[model samples]
Target: MYFPFRQLLASSLALTALTIPARAQISIGEPIPFTDTFSGTLLDDTFLVLTAWRTDTGSVNGGLFGRTFVGLTNEPVGEATVSAQSSTTAPNFFMARNSASLSVENAEAARYTTQSSHGTHTQVEFFTPTSLTPARTRFHWNVSGLTSSTYPGVVTNADLRFAAGYFPTTSYYDFFDLATQENGGPLMSVSGTGAFSYNLPLLLNQPIDLFYHTVAYVGFTAEGGETFSGFSDFSNTHILDRIELFDSNDVLISEWGMREISSGQVMFDQNGRTAAANGGNNIPEPGTLGLLALGGAALLGRVCRRTKKGN
Candidate 1:
């Protein structure tokens, strides 16, 4: 009788460990509140605020970000890019958000595994037309869920990747640009998965806006330099409950939206399609944005012509 009771208790504990929520879904039009957990000088006043999480479900997890440059010029600035500066400039656009949680749970004293995942994401709201004096101006935006995140269980390291340009096949793909400092050096690269910051030399006198996204990847080997694999053996897993963004003073400025991601959701597919929409996501072009910009231009042109006739 004693042996049977012990076995039942052990089985119950094992089942509880195996069953966990991997993904969290929320309503699209809902209003999520942001609380200030940091107080200090910011990188910029404008921020791409967010929150993040981890779950017991998937192999590949991801978040989404969006922006609009409405009422700006239609001329392409080529690909949109981001620049990071210690100080803000006239017409300068910047994202002031930072990560909150950086460490995983202590497994030595605990029973389960631990891990972490993150990277910054920015989408161009708009670019200033070459025809415009400032070149690039104006921006509108939103961030992907969970700007920061972590998960641990047989996983040792995390990797962050950015998309300089991601679009739907229904339209031509336009490259969105981002600026970042890698290994303590400043350089810009086109936005896409692989490595490094992708936006620079593009932030002079431009009022820009940014959006960010983050994802957590779990590794199997306890050692570093592990290979990427699909979600076939996540029966034993760890969860990230909260994600935060910190400032220079080490304060939490923003927290990410956290949820367990369903498995096999590759952030960037072989053909450049994001797993978020399976291949249905779209990016807009300068010309398509021109129609909206043209409305204001038409009014200005008419005003200039009228003044000439009166003179």
Candidate 2:
């Protein structure tokens, strides 16, 4: 009996080891399509946002601060919109559009600031369950149609830009660091294809602790101005069709996307990962726990036989 039980226990342990799935690149699929990926319309849900309209903050120019949507849609407020904007501020949203176009044409008239000569166009922060590594994770985004005249009387130095702390940085809050902005980071742009792309390859693979990290967030401010006068009216249009995350194998791990679905409400996505991305059991996994119990039973049976023989 002893010999058989020992053999059985060893076999069970071997089986458990075999069953554990090897670690691979985490690939979480797109769970939901925002009623309008944050167009912030009547149908939109699960967003944490604060907006102002026709109001001027007199904030520091080229800095992201004052009345920005700092906590805009995150996982905590899933399926319900959490927002505060001026009552008079009409919602600048439309039904979900295919392939994002981030040019002046699609530029939201309601910007971070309403001050004419100085303003911030747009700002968004994305904090996800998974933090991307410079080596293992690569980002792919597309841009189509760059037009400067979309905004009336504004076409000088008109450019479409994103926050520099976007991909490499983990904290959504770092975007507001005045010093970081002072670096005059290069603007968001693509090669001159009818539609261009933003694809950067890292020099070394820098990995951050998973889940505890921040996704990137940046503000887009197109300051269209003249040499003598400061930025007057700002205007630029761009269509951002896709934002994809890939692995070394060139497989898509996640996607921040633009799409339309049929019936069901979209699931919550923190950045590219799902709301449940950052979670784990402190104890052994379920299968391992069960195997441990079976081993204990086998050991008890062996002890019972020895006691009976002594009696």
Specify the highest-lDDT model's number.
2
* Tens-digit per-residue lDDT, 227-299, candidate 1: 2221111112111112222333443333221111233233222222233423332221111222232222121
Model 1 / residue 299 / CA error / Å: 51
Error of 1 at 14 (Å): 28
* TM-score for each model: 0.20, 0.24
lDDT of 2 by residue, 1-311 (tens): 01000001112212222132322111221111111011111111111222221111111111121112222221222222222211111111110111111122223222221111111122122222445532233333322222222333322222222332223332211222223223544234222223433443323322211110001111123232211111211112222333444556665546332111211112123153222212211111222233333332221121101011110
lDDT of 1 at 156: 22
lDDT, candidates in the order shown: 0.20, 0.22
> Which structure among the candidates has the greatest TM-score?
2
Please give the lDDT score at residue 304 for candidate 1. 6
